[model samples]
Target: MGEEVHGPLAQTPTPSAGMQKIVTKHSFFCLKGKWKRGRHVVVVRIRSDRMCPQKFVFTVGVVAFTIAITLGGQVLADRFELANGETIEGTLLNPNERPRRVWLVRSSDGTSLQFDADAVTHVTRETPVQKEFHKIVSEYPDTIEGQWKLAEWCQEKKLEKERHDILEHMLELDPDHVEARRLLGYSRIDGKWHKREQLMAERGYSRYRGTWKTAQEIELSDRAEQTEVAQKNWIVRLKKLRMLVDKPQSSDSAAKEIREISDRHAVGALMLGISKEPAFRVRSWYLESLSRIATQEAFSAIVQIAIDHPDPETRLSATERLIVLGPHQAASYAVASLASEDSARINRAAEVLGRLGVSSAVDSLVNVLITVHTAVVSDGNSEGSTNATFTPSGGGLSMGGGAKRIKVESKNEAVLAALVKLTSVNFEWNPTAWRSWMATRQSPADCDFRRD
Candidate 1:
């Protein structure tokens, strides 16, 4: 009977009656009877009418075998090769070459294959499998995705030129790809390119672009959902702010956002924003924002930043903000900060204290003046200049000195200026009272009570 096997798992048919059985023995043979030199082996032959079915069976077997062999070879060839986001397999080829190549051999069937050096983009031949996996994972940073994948892979694989070409092509395909935006942002920030963050923030696909959008949302929303989406949006903005503020290069767009957010939400968001920023200018901007908003909740944090920040400019800015927000409370902190070792900080504190017209600071102001006088006199005489020559007998000495001298005339003049500012706020230092106190002390030739 004729028979056919069609499907992949179909079995071969048994032989027909026409087939004859022939047995031949070399070294070994199955024996129902023992064979000797004179013995004859029995063979069976049968005639069959259906010859076509037998022929078809033989043909199907040959075709199945060929197909199996072909499939096996393809599987082997695929072993050494990997598509995008796939893992490496089989024996590695030339690892030290510019583009790494690898070989694959099928275990089931002996078939050898070769992979192109460039195709092995992400696999690292240097380290163990686990470490290499981590390295590859790190190669794909959060900001890099889409068209730059090839370039990123090339870069990770140390194919510099290939990476450049891939990046160029990525720009061609999508000019505003997120990966391109991220790389450009990093390069611009590193190069100190002006408005790097602003440019990135303006780009819709940039990683930090979400921050700008979220900031706008927060500004407009009277009540934002505290759900994951809102929190994630805020976190993105916070990260952008951190990036611009913590790095040496500042982003003006980030600064502007911070100022706007702080002005709108001075209580918690502004404080949180300021806490995240490490750069002095960013912190200064944040403090100024707090001043503009001027809420009761931010008063303490502003004072703390004024007192604790290492940068004098930042501290001065914080102090100024605090003064604008709450003049009465800020005056105390300003007066205390005037005793700081940092001269700039002390000067700033003194200026703010004078501006605020804190009567309580008069005693501290007098102490600062005395300390300044002692220091000036101690240093002035060492330069072989008599204090009297600089001080006029009846008339007050000029407050200006050099360029700064033009800014202020004398130590006594600065003190007088402070006194005038204080007196303008109805807290006066009686010149006669200071003169009377001077008279109680022994007067040196350099000392002039008249100027006092």
Candidate 2:
């Protein structure tokens, strides 16, 4: 009902004169005389003390009931099982007769079929809903309006799959069926009905992991995943190469392979090797390989090592490589590290920024001149103490109280040094005065013009 349609639901067509006669007869006979008894109907009359006319009326009623049951069986349908595992669903003629030599049935397509009684394995009675659906289908026309009526009945009967099938049939009769196509998840694209999946396929999209993605997006994602896997492999390979290079038998060949490494993916692996390799000579090899690669990633990694690596010699070696690569690029990374929560890292980054001699580092350096850090000093004993009574008191008393936390304000000497070196003017950890001085000293374009 929510689907947009070019027009309202179609009205059922008026029946022709001949069709009306047939419908009238069908309605009168089927509604009045059809007696359902587990796929069979039997007419039985009990004699009673009644008039001759009553007996005559009862005999006529029996014949009419029998005739209606015989005609209804043509559409009601029964499933027959054969000895060779074949199944047939149709109406069986003379189904009540047990010892008949041949079985006569009408198939779904109105074809009369006969099977040997000996070859029939079993007969399964149709369910009530199946029988009713078949009977309605036989009575209805094959038009879209007629099929829609059947679909609505199926919906009311809670036959979801049957309803879908009927809707599909309606589409076959009229492809532009607005309600049916919309109910079946179809949209009109370029004057034609298309399901969501079909439209996406036409636009070069594919279903991936339960979502639709374009071909370019899927290719990029796949390539990124592959690159990640390759980088992890390189990490493993570099570790093996480090080991092999230490051996006298394989040192030359392993060194050659390490030197030939050019893939940017190997940069992560090389950075890891440089930080973790304990031997100074092996670390030098990693650094040499990184310098030769000399990508922005490698430059940033070496800068990280310079600021964060635990070994002072390795840090100095990496810093030398940074100078050779370019110190201007290293300045931005150092400035970013100044915001680290670790006090040591802050100091290290400030130290590196100062050595780079970039005046842009002065703005960030002013902020970290003094930082206050909270430390929790937890004591198992509470933060209260008691002393024992002296002189004649026989009982001794001792008490302690809860833990305490302290805030320590640290003045970063490296940040102050960097700030003083960059500006040649000392604020002595007063950020406000430093800001004011820089504000007045700024160029015309750099001025922070404001009004309170």
Candidate 3:
């Protein structure tokens, strides 16, 4: 009995005096026990095939279940319908729906709300939304909502043609439409719009078919009759406007009315009136009106305005008009203005130099270019200076000089470019002399110098 053999039985260590004992059964039918104190315990258990596999399987099941739930929620959210002007936090249930017609969905207190599609005038996409909007407006021109939206969109987007067309169409639909009328009137006076009108007139639509019939009829009459009536009416209006300019009485409303008629009806008639009465105020107004009209006949009056007006701004404006008009008369006035000491005049002279193509003024242009270059170099280091440095080279003048030597700036290059263009008109006029001049000027050392 003293040496009786025992199976491999496990023994537990003795508990401390303050510890409590606990016992449990194992699956293998072996006894298991633990020592516990308060809520803490120490236990030992027999390893069994059943217990080891069950714990591993339970953990894998829970992880798979959580993943399935997450994926299913995403799929459901993406399939639901969304309203316009609504926003959703979840993924769209159907991404294939047309974005243009679709609206956003809003979730409030866990419920979704739908908004009317018409509430939104525009649909934004990742591409050129403006171009698409214009196309749609063009396709649906008769829809007032669409046209109005398109007009506003054109204005905001700076689509000049679209804005013009939309407003024109609106006026066509309702001639008395105040907003459309105002925009068209304003457009008629704009430089770009006037240019378009001129282009249209050249293409044989000076006046719209139904509109301005009386003016068109008058324009198509015999040239002599037209001229005589225009001249007579012009004289009458001229006398009235002159009285208004001279007296400036508060009661002279007729003069204002005549001016309005001139601006709206016949700018030429008003100009003829101004030519007879050369009051400074009247001349200024007349010149401004001609600039707005921008016709070839206005060139003569514009030149007179540049030369005879006392106001510097009026003179400068006339010079600008010459640049735009570019008639032979404008060229003559610009040539005279080249001799002016005023910087504004000189600048205007520089502007018209290329346009005028007056090769005889080459010496004057060269002097101007040299003076501008010198002023620029001298002002390079000045503080608190408002003057800008001038450079003939920036205006396409070619240069050549040795290091340490000041370069002589010349307008020969610009003058030559202009001559080349002008001589094309009649190359046989002075072919021999022109060719010789071109060859001599091409050589850097052979440029002629003459003191004015």
TM-score on alpha carbons, each prediction: 0.28, 0.51, 0.25
Q: Is candidate 1 or candidate 2 better by lDDT?
A: 2
Candidate 1 has its poorest 10 consecutive residues by lDDT at 28-37
Query: Which is better, 2 or 3, measured by lDDT?
Result: 2
Q: List the residue pairs that clash in candidate 1.
A: 93-102, 398-409, 399-408, 399-409, 399-410, 400-405, 400-408, 400-409, 401-405, 401-406
lDDT of 3 at 313: 67
Which residue pairs in candidate 2 collide? Answer: 382-401, 382-402, 383-401, 383-402, 384-401
User: Mind giving the per-residue lDDT tens digits that candidate 2 earns over 1-452?
Assistant: 12221211122132222121111112212222122221222232223224452321111012223322223334536766665544445577767786678776654433344567876688767778967775666465677777788788989988676677777767778888899999888998788778988888998999997889998999999999999999999999998998898799999999888977888889999988876788887787788888888888888888998899999788878888887788778888888998787778888888887777777777788888887765444465644453222211122233234444455577899899887776677879799998898788764422222222
* TM-score between model 3 and native: 0.25
lDDT, candidate 1, 8-117, per-residue tens: 11122344545433222111111111111111221223333364533311111111101111211111111222343333233333445643344322222322224444
lDDT, candidate 2, equals 0.67
**Candidate 3 overall Cα lDDT vs. reference?**
0.44
Please give the distance, in angstroms, between residue 311's alpha carbon in candidate 3 and its true position after superposition.
7.5
Ranking by TM-score: 2, 1, 3
Q: After superposition, how far is residue 156 of candidate 3 from its true place, in Å?
A: 85
Instruction: Mark the regions of model 3 whose C-alpha exceeds 4 Å error after superposition.
Output: 1-221, 244-279, 307-314, 324-329, 332-452
| Superposed model 2: Cα runs more than 4 Å off | 1-193, 379-405, 419-452
Cα TM-score of candidate 1 = 0.28
